[model samples]
Target: MSQLKEIIYNCKKATSLIERKEIGRLTLRESVELKIHLAFCSVCRIFRRQSITINSMVKMLFNDAQQRQTKLDDTFKKSLQERIEDKLNKNGKKL
Candidate 1:
């Protein structure tokens, strides 16, 4: 049927639906279409898996960065700068 063909053959639409599903944005029709497409499409299924993985990694990276919002104190900054200067002087490199 033409409907079946439309559902099963649109990789681009399926991939867009996958991303929309990840972000909780898929409409009911889109959700059904993506599910039907994924059921028959191995390549799109692989893409969906990879997209989930990459999304999780990016989320973890941002979460870790947010949790580690540390700042160096003025004294620590000065000490680090002095150490760098000393190293550069020893290597005869002027900054």
Candidate 2:
């Protein structure tokens, strides 16, 4: 049928739906269309797999960065603040 052909042959729409599904749930129509397209399209299937892998890797990197975040010591912070205030005072900026 023409509808089936349309659903299975639109690689551009299929890829867009794949990315959209990654960020949020697709509508029932979009979900069905994407599933149909992916089933028939090997390139699109490979693209979807690569997209999922890249997303997972990026999420892991961000989580690791957040977990290892550090802050300046209180002494260092105070010293930096004092230096900033001194510069502002010298520049005639009220704080």
Candidate 3:
């Protein structure tokens, strides 16, 4: 079908569809079109895999950053509390 051929050749649409596919946002027709395109198009297939890899790497890095930030925040809070307590004790103030 000409529509299928058009879908297969649509690089931009295919790329967006790949992203949608990763997030489960693609409609059934879009999923089918993307699958059919990938089956016959090496370039689009490689792009899809690379996009998946990049998305995974980004997610992993973001999670790692969040964890590190949380740890640092806790450490900072504890250090600040200790400093305040030390200052209060030096000034002969209770608690």
Candidate 4:
């Protein structure tokens, strides 16, 4: 039974690799193990469902950000530029 328990735990860890891979964030060993584990685990099947839901949420958040525009108006941008230039001048840095 302990062996079955360890297999279940490893399967959960492996499902995380699906998201990690999407973000360019997995080691080669992790990638291979996740593939191997997924091949045999039913729990990993449920984990994939949860992973897809979370990934969809992330995609929606990014889409919302892309649809929104910065509230910084022209005057604000100008003020920011002036502040940066002032700081650079004070430090004797060429702008």
Winning model by TM-score: 2
Q: Cα lDDT of all candidates, in order?
A: 0.92, 0.93, 0.87, 0.76
Taking all chains together, the TM-score of candidate 2 against the true structure is: 0.71
lDDT of 3 by residue, 44-75 (tens): 88998899999999999999998887544778
Per residue, candidate 4 scores C-alpha lDDT tens digits across 1-95 of: 67545644685477668777766787877766776677778777777878788888989999998889658799989999999988988999754
TM-scores, in order shown?
0.67, 0.71, 0.66, 0.47
Order the numbered candidates by lDDT, best leading.
Answer: 2, 1, 3, 4
Instruction: Give the TM-score ranking, best first.
Output: 2, 1, 3, 4
Query: Number of clashes in model 2?
Result: 0
Distance from true location, Cα of 49 in model 1, Å: 0.9
Candidate 4 ranges beyond 4 A from true positions:
1-9, 65-95
Residue 28, model 4: lDDT of 78
Report the C-alpha lDDT of model 1 over 6-87, residue by residue, as the tens digit. Answer: 8899899899889989988887888889989999999999999999999999999999998998788999999999999889
Q: Per-residue lDDT for 47 in model 1?
A: 100
lDDT of 2 by residue, 1-95 (tens): 69999888889999999999999989999999998898899999999999999999999999998999878799999999999988998999865
- Which 10-residue span in candidate 1 carries the lowest summed lDDT? 23-32
> Candidate 2 lDDT (Cα, whole model)?
0.93
Q: What RMSD, rounded to one decimal, does every model reach? A: 8.4, 4.5, 5.7, 4.9
